[model samples]
Target: MKVSRLVALLIRRSPFRAMMLAALIAVCSVVFSLVSELSRVSTEGLDAAIFQDNGYLGTYSVSLAGVPLTIEDQFDVVDRAAESLDMSVWRYSEVLPEVESECPPFDQVGRRSLQVMWERPGVPAELDFGHIEGVNAEWCIDGQSIPKDALFAPSSDEEAIYGAQLYIDPAYANLVALSTTDPITYGFYVVSGREDDQVDALRFAVLDEVASLAEASGYAPSVVIGRVDSAEVNVRDAADGIALVYDLIRWGVLLLAGLALMTVQMLSARQRGWFQGLLIALGAGRARVVALVALDTAIVAVAGLVLAVITLGALSDPVASFAEQSLQVQARSLSATSLVPLGFGIASVAAIAAVGPALMVVRRDPLAVLEAPRD
Candidate 1:
């Protein structure tokens, strides 16, 4: 018989069995796909947050003595060293103390720390303050035209910005009484003790778009440099932990589903023993019988896969939300990239479950099968 006709006959004779097989496959596929997607989302979210907050995936700290390096000298050293390194330079800065006078009173400063952040002309506004401790400022690209109310100098001081985290010693925390809402400012004092001579302390900002020339310049000891790069290794490492748990759960579900599919296929094959025997009497080859059985399995598996894709798409939002809440990270959306494993999982389950019944019927003598009573 033609493949289409054979499939139709099988469906007509065992619609419920086919449905059960399909349901099993669909459930397994959905579970695996959801787990994979959730892992991707959680890992990516963590990676992004970490990179954004720190400006670099890795941090290099340099201890400064009481005499701080001049911001110009530090930048020159960093810029030169970054030029020769293999890594991408995103942002670089020196964490420095701001004069108490340049900032607001300790009580009003709240929990916010006052450290200068270096700014660039075309950096994204959202990323301009990507969770480094600081209040939002009306940023100006033109250094020369800063508003009078702006605490930062407009021209050569363009790179200066404040941090949100007010780093205070535990003993001084009560003195500052820094609440989350406090407005904080950081100022610098001039060597001559003239307030007007005060220059904003230098904090550095480097973009990943730049090459690491400074690191190669041999001035590594003069400053602390932080580097952020698009590294998926950390995210993948995080996902591996989650993936292990999901894999175990998926295997258990697959085992149960496989058993159900196997039982149904075997029973159906047994019940149609006479049919099998007659087919053997008709000179149907073993290969033909095997093909027929395999076809049936494929049909069920494909049905399940289709149903799963539909179900997952429909439930993506809820699945994403659950994953985000459980993982405590942003959830990722379903995409074509996640479908490959889903398809493989469903196919594997269907193929494995079909083997026992297919082999049993295929190997049986046609006359014996025909003589056997239907189950």
Candidate 2:
């Protein structure tokens, strides 16, 4: 008999059994999809820690050997070091005193309120500020409260602003003009290079430059440097624990599904023995009967996979919302690559499950099975 025809006969005769097998496979696929999505989210978080916001892999601090350096001098030295080493650097000031602004909270800022001076190579120093979105207030500068209207009122060149009050969204306050000449003993620096493999060599190069600059200034400064990834290693270790748990859940599901498939196939074979025996007696080869059983299993697996795809598509929004609220990361969508494991697992289970039933049918004597008294 043709494979398709045999598959149709099996389903037509045992629609409920076929449905149960398909349902099992569908549940397995959904569980696998969720595991894949969570794995992707954890990977994203790891990447964020590995490469910080400005793309730097390591942070270094600089200080003089029992001496103080002006902020401008420290900035120039680091800037020159970055240029010479072909690296990128970011400068952050210790959180400065927050000034009153009219900008709404969470508008130009994130969940927390902060004010800091931020500088990067090739960029001017600027104020970084965040505030509560709903609260409104006038610009208070140097203890002077000024209305927005008077602050922007027309003025002559002689009345030019020593400092101007900026009004903008809290999330986008980077363009605001700010500069300081305060002296400091140490400077903070975040560095990034093109190749990760050269990080250690690059660190040595940066330290050499710092020493050279200090020598040029007739003072040797103590350069302090540390790898940022040390702390991140702890985070990666935690992710590993989470990944182990995910694996346990995934494999547990696959094992149960495989056992269920095997049980169903074995029981169905016993129930349909007379029909298979009759088919063999009607001139169907033993191998053909076995192939038909395997094909029926394959068809059910395919139907279950199709149902799983539809279910995942319908649940995408809810999954994303859950990920965002609980995991604090966006959920990844289903990809062909992600489904590869599910397809392979289903194929493997079907092949293994079909074996026992096919053997039972092919090994039995067709004459005896057909001539036996009805049970």
Candidate 3:
């Protein structure tokens, strides 16, 4: 029989069977796409949130003489360690509180010591005050560089450290009668400088702010700040979890669908007993029958793949948006890696479904098939 005629006969006689095969392949493709895209988004977002919040891909902290060492000291220690380890130093720092300002009060406060503290409880008491530190541009996390504009300039040399005190909660702000205009400051007595200038200087600067400079030196934080890194890690981990679960579900659905498709194919071939017997008697080999079945399956699989691609493209925005809101993190677009797996999975399912029935038909004896009833 001609290949075209065989295809036409299969399609006309088994339209529902063909549809079932196509639907299964399409579903497989969609599942693959979703899992791939979700995983990529989760991993990338996780890395970003971790790095941003912790100031390093990974963080570790060390204690020195029971007087918790500053991030700068940690960096120095790590740098020395890296040298021994044959690694290059990127940046280093030790914590030192520099004055943030000695200028006209942003708000008129009559007292010299207002006793400001960080609104968030449990932050190191010493760091609670408006102490600032000098940092490299790359190390700065939150603020833009202090412009040459006078409004942001430090009034004295002591205040040259660039930093910002974490903002107080609104409830606390109300309690202190501190309007947004009030110049809230944290206070930290100057400790020994880290390979820098005078420790006795009482001056202050406006650009002082907190930052992470030690990660560049190959050290992580001892404790993450505000659970920033933890949150990101959790989000990505959740995505991976979802992917695993969905993969199992996809396989289960495919198994059921495959069985149904295989059954239909076998029944249809049995109904063509006379034709199959004629082909066998005329010297048609089992290999030829197998090849024909494979071709039919391949065609259905291709159609399913095409349909799956279209469906996923249509759902991309909604999926991304849902992920972003649900994960509470940024979701990146689907990647090439994601698409490859999905396409392969769909093709595999199609081939498996088609081959099962084809093999069963090949096993039947030609004379018996010819003598069998058409139904």
Candidate 4:
């Protein structure tokens, strides 16, 4: 019989064992996949509630909704800052709504005006806004019924490192893009006042000043002071936790897969000692016997991995939904890239599991088995 058919026949010898092995593979695959996706969502989902690069401790944002037409007039309102308070500014000019969106925390920083153009989706998220950091305004979707399919920024992928790029789309609405050139935008003001009460008083004082200017200038100012979400709300700060999870997944999969496959294969090989002796006596080289044994284990490993992948595909969506609702994240993607490591891990474990069985079958003497009494 061909090695392939022979291997298949051998596996069929123990239906109960095969069933047990299949179950193990499926369960582990589901757990590993779900945990990984949850981790990604947890990290990415948080930013919509809070922003990165808060300018200074106790800093808060002051956004002016009804922006003046000319840049100089806009400057006039902010020129009246109290001597004790330090301030920085960024202006919004274009607000091409991706769907239904709100401002980002970084958009509150000042940058050089871009002498640029937007040819319909020209920029990838707040890209038109130059590099500036340390703002106090944090955005939240608390009350807004953000659509289920809304696309979000600070992408869940590796691209999140650079704070500039924003994923732009008209899916539903998760994030808003603000550039210095955007006309209907807020004036991001950085002001110092850590405590809520202190910031509230400062904001009220500014609003009062703007109201006073409105009476004299004939143009009423519309402004609101917003607070940046504090460190308490930040989720990414728990770097150690994420690292621990990754380590657990890696080690756990390796140890479980290796030991389980090795246990089964070694037991089967030791039981078939007389059969192995017959093959050797039939002129099959020790190396050939070992190769055949390794091939048998390889088939089992492939079967386990295949079962795992199929189960993952069937269940990823439901699992993602549960996670999304429970965790409240904007995204939960099961990227294909995550599988690369898993595949390698399985192969490594299978190879280690196959070795003991192959070595035992190869090293045993064919003549001794015939002379020995049957157990």
**lDDT by residue (tens digit), candidate 2, 114-180:** 2233464234344322221224444533343433332221122211211122323222333222422
List the candidate 3 regions with Cα displacement exceeding 4 Å: 1-5, 35-243, 251-256, 317-337
Candidate 4: where are CA atoms >4 Å away? 43-238, 330-334
> Model 3 Cα displacement at 218 (Å)?
26
Top of the candidates by lDDT: 2
- Quote each prediction's TM-score: 0.54, 0.53, 0.50, 0.52
The predicted structure with the larger TM-score, 2 or 3, is 2
In order, what lDDT does every prediction score? 0.51, 0.61, 0.47, 0.55
Q: Write the per-residue lDDT of candidate 3 for residues 1-375, one digit (tens) a residue.
A: 776568768777778877877877777667656665555565566545434443332222222222234534433443444344333232212222222322233223223222323212233223222222231111111222221111121222322131222222222333333222443322222222122232112111100111133234444333211111122445545656765776676566555656666666667666666676767777887777766677777777787777877887788687778866887655533456666666666656666677766776578788887777765
Ranking by TM-score: 1, 2, 4, 3
Tell me the lDDT of model 4 at 145: 33
Candidate with more favorable, higher lDDT: 3 or 4:
4
Candidates 3 and 4: which is better by TM-score? 4
- Position 135, candidate 4: lDDT: 29
Tens digits of per-residue lDDT, candidate 4, 1-375, equal 456665677778877776676666556655666666665665444443334433233545555544343534444454344223554333222334323224454234333222212222223233313122332333333334322222233433322222233322332222233322244342344445333334566466566656755666677677676554354423434544665676587558666877887888899888878877887898877777777778887776677778878877777677667766876554433458768766777778778888889888867988998678878
